[model samples]
Target: MTMRSTMLLLAPAVLGVAAPALAQTAPTILPDATVLEVSAEGRTTRVPDVATIRAGVVTQGQTAAAALSENATRMTRVLAALKQAGVAQRDIRTASVALSPQYRYAENQPPAVTGYQASNSVSIRFRDVAKSGAILDALVAQGANQIDGPSLSLDQPDAALDEARANAVKIARARAELYAKAAGLSVARIVTISENGANDGSNPQPPIYAMARAMKASESTPIAAGETQVSVSVSVRFLLK
Candidate 1:
């Protein structure tokens, strides 16, 4: 074949390959689109089913050994009373124990050691709410010098969580519908859904001093556990039809 004829044939093939490369180099812009982000919260309230109390003995003596011995004697009586009151062995546990030196500080001199202090604390779980007051009174009479806590809680939280989750979904759907209607668009299917699990508020706090005094003086502590609320939140994205 002649050189001019061969050059012509090669030129067409090169141009064919370059055409696609040119198209790839060109920038393409996407059409405008709208996305709606909505957040919904749900809450469920329920009465607590269980209670926990921390009670113990604190003793002070000239030496650590003597202080610990005195604390042990009182703690033993307290534990025995708890067991007699129908508290299971597994439900009772030593939460803390410590021995520290008591300090006596003079106006300008270095602090001096006055005595040794020993403290032993036990945590008791009460499944029966009706008997919680009686149990506390028994511990006090048996020698529990330092008593704190009866943090109430729910034994089984699964049901409450389920209710919260369902409510969250309902709230999200309603919000999406509201936005869609306001913008003059028909309600469409959910494009995406994300959930944040239940956030039950802060840990239970012990009763206030006034309530505690009333409880202490009454024949039986007027035990009342108000409802606790569990809440859940969710974020949802919906596609416009």
Candidate 2:
């Protein structure tokens, strides 16, 4: 090849390799500006609107078949009472069903099978917090011997969490502005924003376990639906000039 033609071909190849390096060198942020990172948290509270409870029947008999049969009879009545109380079928779910042999222990002898115990339980969700207590009482009267929990939670938490997130950003920006002012500068712009921890607070509290008994006509179970807190934390980086 001629010397001029060789030089021309080499120039294009050199330009191709240099183009990507020039693109990569472009600055993402102002090189002369000071970078400040700040973190802040925000929280909001709302009253719980949903409650979860478990109701079950426990029976003991000489044989497993008898124990299960007796448990089924009582459980059927419990389910019926729940339905009559306006509980939706979708809100009711079988939690557990167990059949185990009872054992007797002697000082010098091995354990002996004494009887059989059978249990059946269902988890129930109450959309109306105020009316759940009355419904719970009816469940006990309908033969629910083992009753557990009224775990309180919010039915919807997305709106509350969004509110908290906005508050977090506001707080983070305020903090960055304060720092910039102390350093004799002003905040130019936000360089980066990242969420640290976002909590919806929909998780239920520890449940209350109780053995329910028949109550008088004027008495009913008491359930308190307290406030739940939704919180968010954010880390923000600001460029100061």
Candidate 3:
């Protein structure tokens, strides 16, 4: 080959070998980040703005039709009483209706049906907690034979939950920073946040609530709507510097 041809071939090979090194410059590497994990719980206490109750009637008669008719009549009166007590129609709901045969037992013999029984129930929501007692009193006076829970709750829970969530986040961050500082490190930034659970407390029917069962026509049923607690829990991880 001529010298120029040889030079051209050699130059191409030299440049090809140097291209990889030129592209492979040292890159800046970041140090491993340290993290702190923390968990926190937050709670807020607020009075329930709404209450729910279940009331019903049970009747029996010799015939199925008679028992059902009596139950229907009683249930109609009970519903009217609820409406008069300021319970909106939308808030009153028919929970259940059932008719069953009543049986009598004899020694060493198969039981025989003695009569027919009918039952009807309603679930009511009392928007005004203060008036729930009076409403319950009216229900009893209207001949409600079966009564159940007055479960309490907030009408709208978003605001309460938001407050609780904010508190949880603030506490979680604070604790994470405290732990990081104790370990001779500074908080760099929040790495991740996760919610563990949230709960709005229950309105358990206390023994005192049973007093409504015996309320007289002249007496107002007394009910104590205790405070309800909203709770939130969170887990957080923060970067430590």
RMSD of each: 17.4, 14.2, 18.3
TM-score of 1: 0.79
lDDT at position 76, candidate 2: 95
lDDT string for model 2 (1-241, tens) is 0000000000101111111121133226534446777767778888988888888889999999999999999899999999999999999999999999999999999999999999999999999988998998887888888878877777788998888877877877777777778878888876556666776767566666667654866967778887878888766666677
Clash counts for all predictions: 0, 0, 0
Evaluate residue 45 in candidate 1 and report its C-alpha lDDT on the 0 to 100 scale: 78
Question: Tens-digit lDDT track for model 1 on 39-125?
Answer: 677777778777777888888999999999999998899999999999999899899999999999999899999999998988888
Model 1: clashing residue pairs?
none
True-vs-predicted CA distance for residue 57, candidate 1, Å: 1.2
lDDT assessment of candidate 1: 0.68
Scored by lDDT, the top model is 2
Can you tell me which runs of candidate 3 are displaced by over 4 Å? 1-31, 206-217
**Winner on lDDT (1 vs 3):** 3
TM values, all candidates: 0.79, 0.82, 0.80
Error (Å) of candidate 1 at residue 202 is: 6.8
User: Which residue pairs in model 2 clash with each other?
Assistant: none
